[model samples]
Target: MPRIPGGATGVVLALLLAACTGGPGDAASDEEAAQSPADPAFVADNEAWRAERRAALLEPDGWASLIGLHWIELPAHYVGSGATNGIRLAKGPEKLGMLQQQGGRVWLVPDPGAALTVDDAPAKERIELLPDVSGTPTIVAFDEGKGQLSLVDRGGRKALRVKHAEAASLTGLGPLEYWPADPAWRVQARFVAHPQGKTIPIMDITSRQAPQPNPGAIEFEHGGAGYRLEALEGEDGGLFLVFADRTSGHGSYGAGRYLYTAAPDAEGRVLVDFNRAYNPPCVFTDFATCPLPPPENRLDLAVTAGEKKYRRP
Candidate 1:
């Protein structure tokens, strides 16, 4: 399995080759030069973007740091590293506390002797723990702020998402792999608006389905073939696309990849950059609840750009 989501991997030889000689020599260099735009600014911008992407992944609380995911099925659970606890944590004090789900809210009663924090403040009593659905999940920090636990709601099911700075996945993460910086993968597409309030049922990795906003679709021609991707709402009015192509499981993430297109212009034109396509969070960690591509978004074309599959350390 891949080690990181929003990421991909290269064979061991290719990774070592990339680390030592910049890349696989002549053929790789030729491919990059042929697909790159003549404008130096394009390459510079892509480089800047890649640097920022790596920075995000390296953050202490980034996706790579994820270590555990525990479901909350009962009304109450004694969470701790102790074997006797109902919800045994992967890491923490032997007796962390009691988690009680009452009505629609969740509360945590910390162990008096356990050093913990609720939203960074010292925890000494029971406190309301907000779920992610509230737009601000309460962060329960332990291990001297190196470990964090947060409540997440997925399709009305609740789970504890755990992360630790010293996780093997983070410290042992390998270098990112890619097909190369290709300008040709950046194509201009037309956005076709959907009916007002249209929604699509999207299934996540957990097999739970939920209706998500379907604001529009992006239609583009790649390699002389027509393709359409149902667009989901994105940050700042942009478009979020989850799709699978011929490259899936061959040279990319098997589940699929993700892409973001800026809001369409007045003329309904937008640029879809396949080079910026990325793997989902599930690619890196099993704890992630990433959405799979809907049937309508699967394409037959081989998109030989963007991220390759991720190799774990």
Candidate 2:
């Protein structure tokens, strides 16, 4: 067999199964095509959206510029020695500033007459300070212990608090990689309802204690074998699945990829399209805490669909 670029052994299995089953015009192909939204129009739209998002994430002026992450527990006063202090402002290098903590508030004194901003907003209450490297001075204040950070945008919104950090996503170069868009892997599985919703205990990478939301189980048949998948509820209210099959560690992400099925239809039927399975956030950055697949979701059969393991950068 000619080797396919970026192809793995699992993909070969899926192709063999597809070849043995039927031709391109088979009913199964029709069903798989209907299930997959990879029709030219939808694929074009999806590609456009993904490219836009990727550009936003990778842009230098965007959140990817966040390079500092410090956790403070106690109230302490410190002076910013531009070189010593971890905080780096783009305005200049090695500029000294005053950082005072009083009543759970942090106040920063940038040079006198200089405009100060948080995240990207101009400082509301400006403080006068002595000149260091820059003659102009300004003051920026922040609530203590809040997840907010002060951004000094000289051009627009000089100072504002941004929730996401720039370096966090910038360093996340391990974007999800998927198998080729093959229709054979699109299997129509039946949803077997567990009247009493099933609960799957997930051990998160953070080692945090929490019970993952396993709504129920799904039963499907392939290659004369029976397989079952337990469903999990995601924060977005969409259904997520984390399952490991015989191909784990060999041909797929050892931790498993995530699959989302749309909310059940009026008749309570949901499509489990493996083609959309993707890598979890943990694949990209170590800072992310991802959930592992529960024992029940693990299968004995090889699932040759969705995304393959991400090669960390």
Candidate 3:
């Protein structure tokens, strides 16, 4: 997989002359959306999906909840808001706990009398944990559950990602604007599966490199020009696409946008719907780990659709 999920690209290059395609889990959510429905009901469904996406983003622990990302550089460091801690927290209690890293393992030892919880239950003892990079990460909840902490593994570096319900992004986010929905932008694509167990290099905004599962590439036609995009394995079992278009920096997030598509059917047919495209989590919070679009996924044409650049207040 890709190094960071900020929040969390393209079809691979060998197929650039070909075609291709994360947010909101399974995307517009209508895997069975008619090939090109321009009807009012279809439009309404897309609107509803967008509303859900907006709500999800503002969840207490959603991307907007992120407030800080502190790298764990030292072997042992105290974490808290006090000035004495080695790894000082920007928020939370003055003396939360101690973090000890040794022999490739990290453990959290909460300070006595500090009110901390492990996954919602009171943290009565020290806890061994893994970073978000490999498997499920343990959430260290503090400040009476209003704030929480978790470990993230980025390019072999472990860091703490802090989140809180009071983070500014949750209440300060702007409304999402979209280009007029059009059925024409919903192009039909064909999935060409790669050989069993193939992976490709994925470069993140930080320029870190990692091999991501490359199930195959998706080929499609848009505006009379044929194109292809390399597909990454989405956590939801569908395909994830990272792409950049002519709108970058002008009307969209400069790095690019992301989209999630349902798995190709038996015949390998899929819909590359532009209306469902969305901004990466980085657009909302600086604490995110977003990946950049692979060169192959950069499109010459402007994709005048989907969520626009998020203007931070």
Candidate 4:
């Protein structure tokens, strides 16, 4: 199969999805053509979105930049790059600081002359480090601001997430492959609201389970079959869907793919755009604890749209 390399322009769209070919008069191809919006504006918008997505993944602190994730097991431990430290970092000063967890709070005491910054400001003394759960996690930047260390709390377990500007995963990242953008994959679905205050147990790649807010389910029809995806609360009150189709491990990411939908309209309608589906952070780094798709979200259908599997450079 021919893969579209990263940084390619929109002109290459005609050459996409070479593995899934069909004759010009094929029934499926005709149906997709009929459903596809020919508006130049739509094409331009999708192209722009793809450009933004590529730029985000290539950012210095993006998902591909992840280097390590060190769990804080002991109450207090030395954190640095030296082998003698209790929590050795992949990249940083030999004696970066001391991480201590007291009660329910975590604190970082920088080493003298280590030249660390807390949220971009100089840090010379012990500082309380906040986790992502607080909606504003404290960032401890070192190595001339190229290395970022942040505290993340997952299912009550806290750990240090590290990222570097020059991580091999980022510098050597391969292109993002995708199925051809077919409008037939964009279906308008119905949102069935779940009982208020309901939550669902979500398991991550690390095997830790946590109950996340479950607002509702998006019910849609494709290829004459009905399907449903449990929707989690997403950014700005949107709906986040993590799902696996028959393509998993065949042509797409083995674990699953992520799709985001705008908030349902007053009439309970949602535009489920499968073309925007993307891979999770786990695809770019092994250190990420990405969520697994719940059984209810796994579909037997072969969704031939959205992102394909990622290949390392």
Candidate 5:
């Protein structure tokens, strides 16, 4: 597929699953719409949900805030906004701090009175940092909460990801478009559990290979054709589906889209609501590292339910 290189926060992902109801549009009249209860909240709720999604994506530390992704190569590198620093930050203090890697452990040593915070608390000296792969990551907040620094482990390589609230992409975001909601696209599927310890090779936009846990697969039928999508377990134990369809490069985001579904019931059945599918962070920012859909997850059918393409303005 084409490369469209993309943070997706928890709240934004939650809204994608909960607020998108794949049914009809608004009612004939105001009274009729609000009075008749055929999934009456569909239209109104979706509008409000889209607004929140946009706001969240533009948050101080959202994907739009991303400014740089510098790989940590040396044992210790000076981090600052000035060009003189080894790892120059796009926007931050002139000489913020230094990152030193000890015997497999990394520490952040702040410059004298550089004004950095560890986990929102003042960092007068040095502090250990955890990579994003770890469950808990140490956020080096600086520039008074507008700038954030963190370590990200990509394919066994460590890098410092930088974010600033005043990124140009945040202000240049164009409008988001979507196809009219269709209940028919919100089909059902059955979850088939994979053997224990099953995993799938996930490829990121940067062409890095990362093995992701594959708990199971979602089996469903559309257009009289059977399909299966590899399922990855999310933080809440729900099924996270990153997939591509015929619309991928035609009308939708060239990279693909994402969908979240509830865990399967005892019968191993889950609802695959395509209407709730959304574009990945790559749709908005090139810095985002979104995973590509595996071979099994690429469908020949055109999924015209969720979001449409976002042309940068």
Candidate 6:
């Protein structure tokens, strides 16, 4: 529930506080006061709001616990040795199960009549066994040429397919801390135009290759340091970014954290608020494969804004 800058509640609070102080007969004046131009205090309040959200994202139960990753290869056999091998199930001592591959498709055989379910639906034949984050047996089926899967559970919910693997935020945990939130990190960045539309490659927890759309980069300045962030287009059309700054490795998440921005305005402008940057899903579980920021996305300067590393469970 940490607030991000420009969040909705802050606007409501400002209006309510104004009403409490204004005369009942001067409602129009109160409305005008609320609509007045932004002030220095308003900017400070926004920064504080962003800081709260930053902290919440890095908190335990956030997305950083991902610590294991495995890929489903052709002839998907479940190997049970070593830490990074095949799928690590929460089942019994057997540790490993049987997997078969035929016609470019893979399937798993749960212990005979294993009370398994896919997305809460009763078990079905010829379906893919997926990791169950909800503590139930789940299966998934993929379309012929599509990268996504159709997930089904034991109870019957068809949910979006997701993979399990150790995320960078989970593995790169050293000391969970952050630099103080300095307003200097809040800067107006210019979005560069990329008419051709760039493509950024991402490797999921399964080490599967997925191509993310890169619309362009945001250029900003902080404390005499200049930085650029390359934007990745989310499946929902939102903006996503994986970036590393000077504090990475030593102070921030080694693989890097994520940030999002709304679509650009008519003038093609957006605020690259570092105060809202947060840890990736890998920070909370070992079942998330988060993409690391590419070399070009690594910034040489320190960005002292947003949440620090997560320290508590």
For each candidate in the order shown, give its overall lDDT on alpha carbons: 0.78, 0.49, 0.77, 0.81, 0.75, 0.50
* CA deviation > 4 Å runs, candidate 2: 1-176, 195-198, 235-237
Candidate numbers sorted by lDDT from highest down = 4, 1, 3, 5, 6, 2
Cα lDDT tens digits, model 4, 127-190, are 8999988989899999999999998899789999999999999988888887767777889999
Best by TM-score: 4
- Among the numbered candidates, top lDDT falls to 4
All predictions: root-mean-square deviation over Cα? 7.0, 12.9, 7.0, 8.0, 8.1, 15.5
**Which is the winner by TM-score between candidate 1 and candidate 2?**
1
* Clashes (candidate 2): 25
Tens-digit lDDT track of model 1 for 202-276: 877766679999999999997688999999988777899988776666667777789887889999999999888
Work out the TM-score per prediction: 0.87, 0.54, 0.86, 0.88, 0.85, 0.58
Give per-residue CA lDDT, model 5, range 1-313, as digits (tens). 1113114443333323223222222111211222223254676666776787788878988887888888888999998988889999888899998889867678889998679988678998778889888869889998899989998888778888888898887877788887665555667899899998999988766667678889999899975888888988764567999887666655676566888888888898888777678888777776667787776776766676678878877
Off by over 4 Å in 6: 1-68, 73-97, 129-178, 201-211, 284-287, 311-313
- Model 1's number of clashes is 8
lDDT of 6 by residue, 200-231 (tens): 77543333355667788888876466777788
Q: How close is candidate 5 to the true structure, as a TM-score?
A: 0.85
TM-score-superior candidate, 5 or 6: 5
lDDT over C-alpha atoms for residue 10 of model 2: 41
Off by over 4 Å in 5: 1-40
Worst 10 residues of 3 by lDDT: 3-12
In order of TM-score, best first, we have 4, 1, 3, 5, 6, 2
